[model samples]
Target: MLKISSDQALQLVQQHWQITGEINDLPSYADRNFKISGAQGNFVFKIANPNWSYADLDIENAALLHLVHTCPDLALPKIMLAADGSHIIPLNLYDDAGNTLACHMRLLTFVSGQVYAEAAQQTNTDLASLEYSLGLAIGKLDRGLSDFQHPAMMREVDWSISQLPGLIDEIAHVEDAEIRALVQRHLHYFADNESQWRQTLPQAVIHNDANDYNVIVSTVEPDGDHAQQKNSNQASAHESDPVRAHYQVDAIIDFGDMCFHLRAVDLAITIVYALQHAVDISRVKQCITAILRAYQGVHPLSEPELRILPALINARLSQSVLMATRAFRKNPANTYILVSQIGVHRLLRQFEEIGADELEQLMLSAIR
Candidate 1:
């Protein structure tokens, strides 16, 4: 639903960066990934699709604002909002020959970090700390957003994991029975208990995207004359100091999936997508404990908060299946939807684990 022409994207980027450069759509682009440019100091641009409701746009902005205030160590990009309460740029779309946009356009400051995913796949750079520090950062973020009130807020979507069965029936045309069954089984678990709603989940802002790639890690303190040099991704050069070797949070990017939901839900997301990919389950346990402890040191998780972790995670996993299906149906051209396929497979395996039920029980106890 968030489609923009190549030129319009470049225009928004140029306006925000305060520079002039060619803007071409990057090859193999994902739905969320807008552009990768060799602009001044190397720039990239990600714009929200123009079709989102005004309430949705507010949700995006509110998340970014919440993260910015909650986590001082993390830097969020500037949103180019203009007077009259618009995202500054017009919602312009192009069909066969011209632009035909029906929504407002948004601009973002291109972050300067490598997609940790690709770097891990390529350099094999002992990226273990990359995962841990992300945990720490989100732990900090959790404490930051907990207990905040947003009066002028968008109502969350009223859908739930239980809704997946009806959704599957609606999509009976899904010829791939495997995908169909995956949705059915996953949702069966997700929708099992339906009393807890998003708004009822101790309402707090959360970063829905906690994957390794979304985190920007760098040395906490600058070192050496080369500390400022930019790397292949064109981010600022990192330091060589060993004591400062641990990754620290530079900024949390991407606010499109921001929501007012359970603090445990964010943890569930980080566990499934962010931690599962790079670390072993044992290390994942350590990191989870460390992050939770760190978070508790600040805001202190209530008994109810801890009990719902397993279910929150299940809700997230099932949501992934639905969102992925919608992404594939809507934007067949984007490759990002394909990545969600990997997440779906991961979730199924997670549910099959022997510890799965126990973890759910522990989470329930924490809530009690």
Candidate 2:
């Protein structure tokens, strides 16, 4: 699902280069790729063929291009526009257009970096560095994009949070008691905190999907211990563990899911996915602190934003369920759905495990 063999991409590349007098090698990559390297150096050309139909990715292209020019300090991709001023290769809308052609396709300069997922396989001290680096990187990114005044590129789709209240009715549809209880409890949790959560904050542009897997860790000393070890996610996360060794976060990847949302929403997305995926919760906290400190260091949170962190956690807990249910809604045999199921359960169990005092303490730690 990541690639296309269409000559349209190749033709587009050559046309842009021929017109601009830049040369490149045959683009190679997984999924839809126009990746190239040669006399013109390396450049990465990716696409955005999303689930959104009817001119969806076009708006995303606009948003990305806007962000690229908006943040001068950050290294985001630049679009390779066609000669006649079209973003994609002659995006011809027709009968069954959304199905034949994606909502939009794009190109970006290739950034050289390593992924944190691979880093976890290397050294034992990489986690702290990764966390801190992520904090700084995202803090900088968030700050750089703060003045972004553009409307969101895409239309509003169903946020899983909005679907939470109805989970009580769906609980009857779920056969498993644990699953049913998870949904019911999360729904109640969101309802209890809805007032504070809703009025707490408004949406702003954020790197909504800045997962480690979407990050790249590039290096100068390719052969040094810093070679593979330089960009890593390894760590014990105990107080005794050193923190300075893992801070080499160079760049972020996968802007496909970026959106306008509250800052806590971004934090919650990071914490929710990271805590679930990480081997240790302490590492999650370390990463959270690194990112949060970096964020607040630049753009400090408001009192309301501070108040909403825990409620956002619960809000995210509710979100996890609806997200999981959506995956299963159409596919009974999909393994991906089961993964979301586990995430949904894990978030709920965590919610149920925390008492009022502990919840307050957790919120304080998160905001700190």
Candidate 3:
């Protein structure tokens, strides 16, 4: 794969999208991305991995356009068409060995906000409220996309929860034998239950990668200024009572992982990330409940879906640690791959202690 440098990315953006700006490289798993700021306003320039087929790029672009048209009120970033009026720009880069590398690229208006992951770090923020907002936002997004369909949505993706069982061998990459064994046990559970989940859960076109990084929280607080002022007055009246800041979900980005799958998989992915850093089992349970309740308020989930959610979540967590472990083996110096390893292992152990039956009961109770 041809990795474009900051300079190359800037040039390509200027050439294809007619955007002239100072480009800042953005962190990516397998693609080259940059944040461009100029007279045309801020835009994100993304170059798809050379390995990605034209159909893949077409589906992603089509999904973004569909969302923009159908859910105009949503804070989804607008896809910027190139000078040629094409959503995707084709590029051919060369490796040092002079081999040809073909890739697809696109530009999108930059969604201005703090990433949900970063926003979660602020002590003044109400996390329960934020998680609720996240659930509601995702529920609405999924509802909007319910009617949308594309052939590319069925593309094979290793990260898909359905594909988690195949990664069992990756557990060998885990150095800690105890952690590996735990992951293996969960993998076995997922494998054993996969067929039943496939038969029961509600399926739809879902934004599969709703992890913290892709979820953007707008800087604008959801509570209006009146509420803030009221809270401020209360705090002034009693110095001990502090005002907590409430935020809203600004936008959801990165539709590259969008796929045809169980609607619950989206919630499972979100819950896995939300609870990754949870301090205790209670907090983990609380986060799950809060998210599910908010989602149910927007889009009620069926009991069968709820029953299989815990297993799907475990499957997602297992996918994370296994994939991270595999990536770590390839690039030992990359810290991003291991970002969730510690938290994932902790959550897995807690889940084992809680047992799947009780976990399902907890989720079922929340939605009820």
Against the true structure, whose TM-score is highest? Answer: 3
Q: Model 3: clashing residue pairs? A: none
Question: What C-alpha lDDT do the candidate models reach, one value each?
Answer: 0.54, 0.56, 0.79
Model 2 quality (TM-score) = 0.74
Give each model a TM-score. 0.68, 0.74, 0.88
lDDT of 1: 0.54
Query: How does model 1 score by TM-score?
Result: 0.68
C-alpha root-mean-square deviation, each candidate: 7.5, 5.7, 4.0
Better model by lDDT: candidate 2 vs candidate 3: 3
Ten residues in a row with the worst lDDT in model 1? 228-237
Off by over 4 Å in 2: 1-8, 16-33, 47-55, 66-70, 85-89, 92-103, 121-125, 158-179, 191-202, 219-247, 340-344, 354-356, 365-368
32-115: candidate 2 lDDT, tens digit per residue: 555665565566655544454434455456655766765554566666665566766533322333346434445566776667
lDDT, candidate 3, 1-368, per-residue tens:
45568888888887777788888988886788899998879999888888888888888778878887666656998889888898887888776688878988889999988888887777666666677777778887887787888888888776777778788788877887877887888789988977777686668888899888888886544456324433422122232334666677878988887788888889889889888545688768767776787778777788888888888887888888888888888998998777647888888889888997889898898655
User: What residue runs in model 1 are displaced by over 4 Å at the alpha carbon?
Assistant: 1-47, 80-87, 97-99, 119-128, 147-152, 156-186, 197-201, 219-246, 278-287, 297-299, 322-343, 360-368
